[model samples]
Target: MSNIIQRIEAFSQLGQFLSQFTTERISKKEQVLHNDLFFDAFKMQVERAQEFNGWFTLDNVLFSCEGWSKSLTNENLNKFIDSINIKKNTPKTIAIIMAGNIPLVGFHDFLSVLLMGNSVVVKQSSNDKHLLPILAKYLEYIEPSLKGQITFTEEKLENFDAVIATGSNNTARYFDYYFGKYPSIIRKNRNSIAILTGNETDDELNGLADDIFRYFGLGCRSVSKLFIPKGYNFDKLFNAVFKYKDIINNAKYANNYDYNKAVYLMSLFDLLENGFLMLKEDTSYASPIASLFYEYYDDSNSLKEKINSDKEKIQCVVGNGFIDNEIAFGQTQLPTLLDFADGVNTLEFLNNL
Candidate 1:
């Protein structure tokens, strides 16, 4: 327990250190541990992260860090841990196969494993191989006990007692076949959606813009689809979301937009566009970059039933007074520590294992 408390303190300190870098800029503060050692190095890591992954823009990387900084507060950490019972004190090596779609996407799993007195062998996606390793180094420096507890490998996993793997639907099958012998949590592709009632305030629509535009709609929590009322006027939605038009300036995003738009044009699919984002009437939950799929619903109950039936494919529902436990608009990316992926209580899973 004393060791766990020390680990918590070390993570909190890391939060404080991460707070220095925001979407605005990266600034060093004096009280952060090993500032002289890690501050500049982390900045270089951020730059290299973008160079390595085209989706990892500086703004997105800093935004991810900022969210982590806020989530790693002592109060939040305690609250998250308090909900679970940690009885597995004997350390077991847990293998984590992470997704590369977003920055530090696997940190929550990593933290969960470490906080539960387990070792982690992380198999990071090649696209997101930069940030978390450095942060792990920082954690090891702050808490020397964590040095051997955490390991990264590019090769096939071995000698791990349990597994946490995240990937698309196809890779999930692979994970199931390979890691089925172990206690495991394998996640499949899931996307988020929004429900619009035509009565939403402009502020709410604008907030939805953040949910859609953040991370370029690559995250599972990003709003990739919308369920709007029949005959809804899209002018207001377009007007509100247009504030994020600057996103098209990104070369990668623009290329995707052009490619998807050309494909849609060739296929004769109807699309609504405002120069940056395109909206298509599609039934699929996952939308390509720079595009969102929307479906018109006749009533809320039927829509609710449909959503509930397809819950496995959905990550979150963002709306106003639409669904129970729905995420508020613009807040999908700012998940609290307790917001475990796939609604599986990660801490509890680790604790019981």
Candidate 2:
């Protein structure tokens, strides 16, 4: 096999490593799987990654695809790949300061750096301290030699050829000031948004539920804001999300819902004509419940312009006939090995650099 193909194969095996501790059959460390909040993170990815060989295969296949390996639209890939192909001897180390908003958000950068033949030094998030090591450990079990290349550290960020960091808007400024001197892809505060027309059906809305509720709506990829058409009825939207009412059952989430609800009611009793916890209303991308997010819009074009003006603050757009429950956002635990951060084409960036 070609050397490039061989490298892809080696890295793709990480899926197997991560899948070993199936998200379903939680390792002994997990005291609870499903609870008052929702299915625990990695609750879905591990089972699906392990059982669905088709998806696992697709994950690996897509990793090797030009769209991923080249990390650019087809037009951009050709130019980038040609340049990289000519610079085989250039050595690089990519220091990734990963976000822990959703589980395994860091993995995407990890895979990209590895596939491109750049060594990685990762500084993990404090909140989400699990999974990466489990993945790294399993990968090493299968291929002992790779143990050296993948590592998790609390190390200070110094002496790296390049850097990629994902964090809050406040932190981004700091990251920029500290790390901007070098080649970097430092991301700031950004949230995904959904645009809605009144015509959406039950299935479409449920799909949107995953986008907003997954990772308890904490990640940048989560729907921090939403855009809906004028006079959109909450009845229809709530009806769509009702299946996930169980999200309230999770203890942490339930606490958030209750706490926020009480605060809203006490602060503005008359303004809150709607009930406790989540009220039906027009508002913004931030949600009312502990594990929810929302935003409402009256004019689609106006909101589009608003979003366009602030594109850096927004991530993916979800809505209307396009939403599908099958397509998860921030597939927290088992991120597609190829998904790049900040929608920036890392390989293309490297090639151009």
Candidate 3:
């Protein structure tokens, strides 16, 4: 059996391997173990992922790789591991149902299960099926004892003690019905929001633009709605976010922008647009692609109370000390290992199981 030290070292090495594929460039380093065998293969997989899923552009995939590389360091992994208690018991198999909204979105769950000395059976989203398997192969190569511990399947899952599933609200209902008897963590629809005061500087607003536009605003961590002062100026935000105006060049994104704009205009709805993005006054949390929704808040106390009331529907609150547990302006998409989704402690759940 592989001990905790070996597991952590293997993951740390995997992090080192991922460091080569950042958004700046994909350079090969001779120091990386097995690079002669795996580097070119992984690079091809990245390109293949972009070709298969239109939303998975090459740069966005590299950005995801960059975030994971920064997160999977020796210091960070050790800190996360030391925070939890691992028992010496027989290992069990954990089933993971992943979401494909962004590249490698479900990797944290996969890492949690394996690091806790449990085997994993993963059912990947078709939209993201190309990347993780190759990485898993690399892990097995680095740690031979990890063989036979990981499995990927397309068939119905069976013989698993617990499950971690993420999907939309409708699929969550089915997962609840099927996996209810087992110890499970079932995640449903959730969106992130931002609270803006008129006092934001240009740099902070630019970071806010990243929170809204990265991954084309598809991830749950992406800010889809805003709570602003009653008489806020939109010009500051528009000017800051104009740096991302090139996003309109992507055909899929442009199609959504044009279609949604047409619908809003035909319905005679009031809107503010700057040719690339649109701002609509909506109370809903989930906004369409290329559109942002905003609401007016009269007082901070009432806004905080309302947010607390709707905490379950919210994933991140990007602000500058406006509330407890708020994320900084541009840090939503660059979550660390400890930033568990839905505010649930995945390691704690695995430990108890």
Candidate 4:
């Protein structure tokens, strides 16, 4: 019991350490010098969080880890070191296919590999390759230990023990076929949701927009759907979001919104066809197109039935207004220090291997 207490303490300290990494390693001004991919990703994260003035809060960072670690057991912790597989000594490589959305989507995968005690071979997302390394300077301050383990590459993957790839439903098939034989985890298209009690004031409703639109609706963990009590009028919801119109006012978002809205309207008349879609709502948690943030539903009696029915499609649910065991979208995966793949808890798996 005392050992468990100490282990928990270590995680708490590690959480604090990592929180500082987000704030200290990342900079707003120096962000301009990053690759364009990271520049836009960071901008979206900062601006949407309304922390544009503050960058990332150490509090949020620690909160994310705490949220993720809720399910870890003392038994799991005891076996963590045994579950991870790493080649001993120099140049042992692990391949990772990173997510493009959100700031430092790659960082999740990078952190997994680092914590698992392996060298990383990263396939930087072409869409987001521009901005993630802004932390190279900050990481230098926090952990000189990482300086040796990190390596970037565009080269063909070769000579690696494990591969971790994240992509859409389509790309996942290819990942399964090509990377299947090797030890791997291939992530498919996942959508997140939020359960609403409809008790929120205008202020909380508006804040919900941050969970929905923080990364321009690109993150897998962002609220992708909403479930609400019956007969909830959208007027109140729209009023809340309308307050954040300044964000929609941004040229890029406005253009995308207009483009998606046009496609949606056109689709109503069967006038246009292509890679476009628009979803309607009284108060949805989902955005349309390449990403979904949130959605709303009125069915109460059948709520759990509906969710369980679509369980295969739904990846995570952010149940607001719930107590005790309520978990959010980002918290779906119980990540340990070594759950290096698609949020799988690898330490437990490799320990037996």
Candidate 5:
């Protein structure tokens, strides 16, 4: 088999192994590669992931795993990398500094670097330290040639040809100062928003709920704010998303809800609530946990222009025909391989390097 084909097959096998752990729970499937060797161990890793990071609930962890399983199919893999040439040469080392906001949050960058025929040195966030390493081990065992291409470090990174770092606005400056000389992709805080036209169906609004509450609104693609027509009532939205009211049962989410609600009440900020989510009027793109910010739009055209002008602060805009290349409502988290983060093509960047 060719080098790239072997690598791709390794990833595909990893995806099939991960598909067993879905939103339901982790289960062992017969005939999977390495199932006899690693199945029990990986299940333990899933539990360990949540124990290390309270935000990495089993459901969310499995959700992330399922998404990758679907994306790593042969067809999707071919489509994502076919346009970008990767030669079998001495590959450069790409150091990646990953965020821990959600489960397997940095896998795409890791996958990108590997698919570009480069070695990766990863520094993972302490909050998300367990799962990816186990998956990497599975990959190495599947394709022995990949044995030395992946490395994980807890110490400071060194001796890398390029870098890709994801962090908050504050950490981004630090990365820029440190990695400015290297060919790098340093991502800062970016939040998604939903544009409501007062004509959305109940199902669409429910889908929007998935976008908002999937990762407890921690992902860059999570909708933190909303743009609604002037004088539009939020009753329908609240009703549509009410089915997700069980989210309040989670202690962390409940604490955030109670705390933010108390703060809003103490400060006399006028807001809307539905026993779980709080909607406050604000202009910010990034909202706090358990709270969503909203703004009034007088004209759709003007709103489109505003969103266009502030594209850097935005990630995915969820709406129907609201703007060019807008993400459909509720599909923000279901990003395809071609849906590169920050609209920057990672393969192209690695090829150039």
Candidate 6:
């Protein structure tokens, strides 16, 4: 098997390959490796993803690709790898059960297991099954030694040393029961929130809109709720996010908006809405599609205590300076490789295993 350096180069090459598919356009770049063998096939897979899953629109899939392209650079990969201590040991096959809520959501775990010189048997979410296998083929073509190291499966997983599973709260219970004997990391439902001080500039507010609306708020990093100061003007936020009004044109998103809106109206819930988005005052972190739940905070200290108490339910906190490790306005989705999900260090977990 190739050493860690070679593995890094393979992923960096994969990043270059992904650069061709972005939100702006999908044009082939000649400099990327194995383009003749993989480019068009990968493009077709992107379209197939959109056709198979209503949430996986072309723009959203491309955005995911674009994010990976940026993250897989040589500098970023090296930095991420250098942060961890890699022990030369016999390889273990790690079982991964992935969620399909957003495009390539499980790719991070897939990459992490491989980078640690471990084999992976992936059970992908049917909602997001198309893109990763083709990309895995690209990896094999770039580094033939990796061919047998990666495996995708629909059958029951076996012959693995450890497990990592992501799902909703209900499925998490099952994962805990079934994988209890192994060294495992089980992730359940969690949502992101933003803290607003009413002093944000228009650009900052626009960035916040990206944090909220990107991926149709399906990813765990997506901001689904807000904590704003008392008497904060809603008009400022509504005006800033108006540029994303075109999101309503997507049939699936529009359907969700209409349905959620009807339910809210029928329940006599007070809501503040623009044509595309609706905001309701609530305490929950996971808001339904097309609606953002917000809470009024009288003071920052109390809000901080509240968030700290519910840390397990929160993913990324979007704020300027409200708390330690707060993600700046719209940057939640652009997490670096070191930003482990659920605050569990995946690389460290794999290393310890």
- Per-residue alpha-carbon lDDT of model 5 for 1-353, expressed as tens digits? 22777778888888899988888767788879988878888888887666788788888988998899899888888888897776555689999999999999999999988877789999999999889999999998898888888999999899999999999999999999999999999999999999998999988999999999998999999999999888888999999889889989888999999999999999999989988999999999888999999999998888989999999999999999878889998899999999999999998888888
> Cα miss at 69, model 5 (Å)?
0.6
User: What TM-score would candidate 5 get against the native?
Assistant: 0.97
Off by over 4 Å in 5: 87-89
TM values, all candidates:
0.98, 0.72, 0.99, 0.64, 0.97, 0.98
Candidates ranked by TM-score, best first? 3, 6, 1, 5, 2, 4
Cα RMSD of all models vs. native, in order, equals 1.1, 9.1, 0.8, 8.8, 1.3, 0.9
Best by lDDT, which number?
A: 6
Compare candidates 2 and 5 on lDDT and give the better one.
5
Task: Pick the winner on lDDT between candidates 1 and 5.
Answer: 1
RMSD of 4: 8.8
Query: Order the candidates by lDDT, highest first — what do you get?
Result: 6, 3, 1, 5, 2, 4
True-structure lDDT of candidate 4: 0.52
Better-scoring candidate (lDDT), 3 or 5: 3
Error (Å) of candidate 2 at residue 240 is: 1.8
Q: Write the number of the candidate with greater TM-score, choosing between 4 and 5.
A: 5
RMSD in Å for model 2: 9.1
Candidate 6: residue 156 lDDT (0-100) = 93
lDDT of 1 at 265: 96
The lDDT for every candidate, in the order shown, is: 0.91, 0.55, 0.93, 0.52, 0.90, 0.94
Q: Model 1, range 146-168, lDDT digits (tens) per residue? A: 88888999988999999999999
Q: Per-residue lDDT of 1-353 in model 3, one digit per residue for the tens?
A: 58778888888889999999999999998889999889999999897776888899999999998899998888999899888876666788999999998999999999988888899999999989999998899989999989999999999999999999999999999999999999999999899999999999898999999999999999999999999998899999999999999999988899999999999999999999999899999999999999999999999999999999999999999999899999999899999899999999999988887
